[model samples]
Target: MSDLNITHEFGYKNNPNSQAFIESFHSSVQREFVEYISFNDIDDVYNYYMSYIYFYNHLRPHGSLKYLTPDFVFYLFNDNFNDFISSYDFSDFFVSVKK
Candidate 1:
């Protein structure tokens, strides 16, 4: 096995902006799927996660995306995603950062 060294950082100490989003996603995964589901094996785990991730990105309404699914927002603002993101209000999601 390969040794991988990683640092532990609590909350958003490193990057307040993006860290909040990352934390929220992790929390959602725990709450939405991990807490209640059990997998028979590795393949089952992989398959379930693949479906869940697709649903989360394409069908779920994210408040940060203005209550739009990421897929819709992505296509709607595909030309300049950064520009579209800059105009929207992220406060809806940003304010609810966990820890």
Candidate 2:
């Protein structure tokens, strides 16, 4: 849904974990974005958020997947991780230390 006011606007039905996760995510996002930014206007905040979102999606490593980024695993490995599974091809391409 487009509405970010998830908890207040649309209450979590049976999943309380989702609410916690969203709260945690909001805290993290604030720490990473809102806390540092000096908001002059909503447009400026939106622009900054767009850039941050790009970084989160494309650059940040996911902890669940052995700390490898989604793009790094899919696109960086040419979408075929098995191709480099034989050798240290894709594994050694980036940081050897998982994340």
Q: TM-score: which candidate is best?
A: 1
Weakest lDDT window of 10 consecutive positions for candidate 2 = 87-96
lDDT of 1 by residue, 4-92 (tens): 56675566457656577777998999999888689999999999999889878866788887887786677576787777567755543
Q: What is the lDDT of candidate 1?
A: 0.75
TM-score of every model versus the real structure:
0.61, 0.51
lDDT of 2 by residue, 1-99 (tens): 348655545547896576775676677688988888888899999999998887665566667657776556675557565554564334423644565
Report how far off residue 11 is in candidate 2 (Å). Answer: 6.7
Backbone N/Cα/C clashes per model: 0, 0
Candidate 2 backbone collisions, by pair: none
